[model samples]
Target: MNVSLTSEPLRPVVQTRPVPPALIEALSQRFGKQLSLAQVVREQHGRDESSFSVPPPDAVVFAESAQDVSDAVKLAAQYKVPVIPFGAGSSVEGHLLAVQGGISIDVGRMNQVLAIHAEDLTVTVQPGVTRKALNEAVKSTGLFFPIDPGADASIGGMCATRASGTNAVRYGTMRENVLALDVVTASGELIHTGTRAKKSSAGYDLTRLMVGSEGTLGILTEITLKLYPLPEAVMAATCSFASLAEAVNATIQIIQMGVPIARCELLDAVTVRMVNTHSKLSLPESALLLMEFHGSPAGVQEQVETVQAIAAEFGGDTFEWAHTPEERTRLWTARHNAYFAGVQSRPGCKVISTDACVPISRLADALLDSVLETQASGIPYFMVGHVGDGNFHMGYLIDPNSPEERATAEQLNHQLVRRALALGGTCTGEHGVGLHKKGFLLEETGVGAVAMMRAIKTALDPDNILNPGKIFEL
Candidate 1:
């Protein structure tokens, strides 16, 4: 599984354009207390959870409504300044960085659940609403939003990244769940795409386009998403395996057999050990598979039996069930905290997290190769995977002041991405191409496709003021 390493040359940094003082003054006069020029506030708006160097925005605007967002965009367009949209700041791919030094429009104040169509299994909300909040709001209706990306990310941010999580194997990602959006274009005009209906023969499918555009096309102000009914019966369990391949193979077999697994996650021995220490649990420090089944009681039992047989064939140990709701929450919370646990495992070290996905059959090859290479790289790292969907992430711990460590991590990322592409997979699965994977986009999609994307950017934004220097540079 180990592969030779080759370093890819880093892209040269493009100089950021300066913001106009007149625009800042005008915004200051209009927004008054809502506008902040404080150094700490600008710094807060500049970065997300990524290890990328922070480049704080020139100013931060606390937007409270669609009008606020529209007005800010219009002003930025007038002054030809970059507009970086800020959400929960949970993005790990440098999506929220103010790379071009513009005004960041903070939408956290606009959080609101607009409407819930319980009968139709759909809900509309302002972009700032978090997934947890949305679920709490609709809990009384015997329904819930299933798209959980680990973080309590803002709906706007989740849509921007087209995020998915452990449950994506069954429930799907944001791309499939989001039905409509009210977007503020580069010119500050609000336009609606798609509708509340379940199906549509839309003209341009602009809704899909904007879903993962990474704020380059427009700023999402309102979102309409599909919801699911709470399962009648739910069960979660963890199984230990002698090796990583065995765990991954068991998952592959379960998936290929068409078992309706609600969630199928793989955590390597290193990750499991970190989670155990961080979460104060006694999970065996072996390659592990965490699974969830959802259906009628009979259906759930059937799935558990099928999965148990599959796991046994791969030498997996007995399943340890989380019988109660509180136990299930604790299990998932530990899984979601894998990144932070990895960070805490190494004091004073920052993490460079990256993800890739391939066909279900290629999951083992991709993950094994990555794990082997990382182990040989002499880097401190933790690995986790959503094996049913063939997506996984590795977080490399490094000292922030060490350029050599940063370069090594970047090289490891380049090798992993190239391997994924060779296996007919994407450079990114859920995490969108922000600043980190811009070069790899051209490699995954050909020049012609990338050129078409650039053309679309030009045609829509024209001025290149909306989230400038992201995805593919103009």
Candidate 2:
């Protein structure tokens, strides 16, 4: 397929309006000098990881408290301006993009560990607190938040995306971690959803409703999450495979055998090569499985034995164990660097990554076929995945400056998404359906589900003044 340069820039529908002097005055009265109008710029507000080019908001509101959030939302509602909740800015699907161009509600200033109930196994935190920051603060509490998206994203943003990572196989995703939330509705009402109880038969699960809403419904102020005791012992190991099929099969067997593996990531040969080139680490030019196990000493030893047996059945190479703390950290660090490594493979190429997940039984067949098709198409791509959860990412390196390559990359991405949905998998496993996956969402969830989602959005945001032109647009 030949590509043509799009004459128009990829931007949101633009609507021009004068900044409300009243809103600026109100912000000044409340936040003193903390809130600045100059922070809003075309590049600063609407920027995101997606290729969607957009202008920044008219103003940037720095909210340091729930009340501050309420005030900002109230002013936005009063002026009928769009309100975008910004956290961490790590979202790949254009979650942070201010499509309607109003106020960018930057929440990073509100980061704080509000309270910790080690006994209840729950912690209440301000929305701006990042996973790494929260964990660092709570390290001495003997309990920790388990969901790790590897991006050091804000707890609120992770919840907003319903994100999961390698550890998701055991700890589950944000869908299971979030217990409650403090949200400022579009009308600027402060509402508390859910409870601190272990379980509840509430009328509607509003807390869960807001989990992956992607800042379209309301602004997340505080999040209460379930926590777990730190594991007694953790071990990480990497095993090589001659083929991707063998590596996937080994992962499936281990999962089926009921061994509580902590994390299992799969990296195809192409991805391994990228990691080697970018990270300056020596990696064998073969498919690799980075696995970790968490449990008591005796339990971990037993798991190692079981996993070893399963690996042998699939022609897996000898498992390289990292028992020491530093060794385990180093092992995961290399895996986390896979994305950067992938982007670095091409000197001036940018990446367009797709996330898909299928049931464990079909994972190997789907991934093998999809990857083979991708490579046969002559697209330079890297494959990385949290294979334990049946989810994987394919990163296509493309020179956006080259119209031909961009067209090929987009076509390949669409094909991958189509194939994933056809295989009874989600178009996106962890990444939320931001602007990037809207088409896939329609295909995967069907028009009926899409209509229902639209209905919910309409009910919550009638004015469409919150991250407009994202997820669904008429």
How many backbone clashes does every candidate have? 0, 1
Which pairs clash (backbone N, Cα, C closer than 3 Å) in model 1?
A: none
Model 1: per-residue lDDT, tens digit, 1-474?
A: 233234434433555778889999989887889999999999989877777775799999999999999999999899889998999999988898877788899999889999999999999999899999999999999999999897889999999999999899999999999999999999999999999999899688999999999999999999999999999999999999999999998888998999989999999999999999999989999999999999999999999999999999999999999999999999999999998899899998988877899898988888898999999999999999988899999899988888898898988898888888888888899989888788788878888999999999999999898888889877
lDDT for 184 in candidate 2 is 91
Q: TM-score, each model? A: 0.97, 0.94
Best by lDDT: 1
TM-score of 1: 0.97
Prediction 1 global C-alpha lDDT: 0.90
Task: Indicate the residue-level lDDT of 474 in model 2.
Answer: 46
In model 2, state the lDDT of residue 107: 91
**C-alpha RMSD of each candidate structure in angstroms:** 2.0, 3.4
